[model samples]
Target: MHRSPTAEAEVAEELAEARPDLVSRYAAELPGARAAVLTRLWRALAYEPLPWVAARVTDGDGLSLRLVDGRRLDGPPADPYATAAYVTDVRLDGRTYDDPARLMTDLGVPHSSDLAAELGHSVASLALSRAGQPTVPPKEGPGADWEWEQRVVDGHPFHPNCRSRPGFSVTEQLAYGPEHRPLVGLRTVPVPAAECLVSGGWPEGMRDGERLLIPVHPWQAAHVLKRVGDEGPVAHPLMSLRTLALSGEGPHVKTALSARLTSSVRDISVYSIGVSATLSAFAESLASRTDGLLHFTRTLGAVTADSPDLAAVLRESPQTYAGSGERVVPVAALATTDLPSSAAWLAEFTRLALTVGLRLLDLGVALEAHGQNLLVVLSATGAPLRLVYRD
Candidate 1:
């Protein structure tokens, strides 16, 4: 989140190119059209191991990464953006123990920290021990080791997602001190489905004021919405509506997108808005020119359905001219043709974006190049052809 778009996208593209196998694995998540473009965009990118790669231990897990020319990445699968973890060593809080034995008594459960964090006003319980508690055996693990515990507790460190995993649901603070504002856990639906932000609202004295939609990064929202309206896939891949708000790994796409955006080397521009708002804004942005939004959309749809070569150009231009803040559905998962080598796929991807004036290749941009983001539909010949992009 802290890195610039150029830096973020560049990093993502690098990762994508480095791990084509991952990208290929998640190709089904995207639609056919976007799969074409992103497949090419990602495949076109050159891969180079920035001098060296490294590894290390973060929290309780292992992390590995490379020291690319940009962001100072510590190796060994480390999250490059973990620097923005909600909890770090800086949050102010204190722990006191009246009886170390009582504190020492195991809570008798897995994920003790989570239990500790929520039991009897969780966090405050740490200070609940009677002044001086007996010394309980310190929790031992790569992350819960003696050194980390002593430093964090005595140092008053704030932990970020200590018990959370990547793409996990995040807990957002309820505003208005939960007085005028209602509190609800942000949820993520495995498959996109219709769900209200708050569950069973307005009970007696409580009144529901608002409902939030899927929580995604500012740049990603517009692009995904555009994909929803893109041609093909009359019924969503699942055919069932599954919507996941930014919660847990289910909806927390921010960091993943962060990795993608930070991985590209292009001019990224994003105007945050709802699905309708994005549509209207994009429409207006192109209204004054010879190419209206509808015309562009139809052109993409038509070319993709009929001519493979034309579809490639239609896909390419909009991505380029529209700017790399990556429009909705930048990548599709379906294969539209039976072609070999990156040339054919790249051509197909480029043609489709051209219709909308999104030149992803010309500008040297790669969006959602991750395995799960790019979808490649196969042709009769058993080769990937059509491309698509989705959440």
Candidate 2:
């Protein structure tokens, strides 16, 4: 999947021709990548629920898990709250296995080869991200909100394929990936209002008489939409590459990006488009009861052409909550920022987050309040004031 359609044939031909030691180099890179993925997988096997896991034993060093096949896997203790974990070698049935593929082979599990290949991809992707790290260190302070997003090289704390992006060549990764901090140019297609299903009230500015403007990611336009025209305005790429924020200040646009990012291929479903306005209203009403401690962005508009791959959702940017000088930072990027990490600051943030999240859940709407979906409005002195939750 790393090769796009244009380069797929070239790569296949290169593989067929044994000119250099490309195969040997790839073989050399496999062990390190596999080890990194296996460490995360082992942590999941130890902490998360897996039917094949027969039992678990905890000790000072780490956790030991017994699989259904009577084989044992041991790794360092898992700290779910921690972002980056130091996972090196895993012990499997008294044998130390650094390569995930080898360990999976020893386990004799079904679909082991497929899973191993995925792990390899993850490992390779992580290495590329590391290599692309900013040569010059970032400025002393949290210079910009987008910088925080770019600093998140190590993605998900637990998932093995956290950085895995199939079908994205190295060049594409540099150009479009949020970690690379590239300003991606969106493509716009104006669809007549009569031809598109409109919900949540399409913004008047984006509407031209009876026609509505729909923005599409360039990759989506080329690969999935199968049509490209009108180079739209550029925008800053957020942690979620599919979402973009216009320059100066405006709404955050969620475009339908047709690609596998991490685990799921992100596509704007027709179901979401149909209920966007109603859901936004319901969410705002629920959030209003929280006494300003929480804010859920209003869905400004949603438009779709009766297709899953072609849709866009516009919502209020989280920056709206911050006052003149206050800053709103994504929770996921907090670890990479220079914001105050003192105990008191952390406790206040925890209280603010829990109060808002639990209250929303109590109100019958549970938000997927992960790092990307959550943002904190910090005072000039770096105090947590309020929380923002967005889809």
Per-residue lDDT tens digits for candidate 1, residues 16-124, read 5543433332223112212222122111111223233232224443222322322222212223222222111110012222211112122222343432222212111
lDDT of 2: 0.74
TM-score of each: 0.22, 0.85
Please write out the lDDT profile of model 2 over residues 1-391, one tens digit for every residue: 0211222233323433532334344344444555566667776666787777899988998888888988888888866654444566778888876655456556667677666555555766665555555568766755566666667776776787777777676556667878777888888888888999989778777777888888888888888878895677688778788898876677789999878877788889999999989988887888789999888878899999878788999889888888878888888878875554688888888889888878877877678888888888888888889988788
TM-score of 1: 0.22
> Number of the top candidate by TM-score?
2
Please list the Cα RMSD from the true structure of every candidate, rounded to 1 decimal place: 22.4, 5.1
Model 1 CA deviation exceeding 4 Å by range: 1-46, 49-283, 287-331, 336-352, 358-391
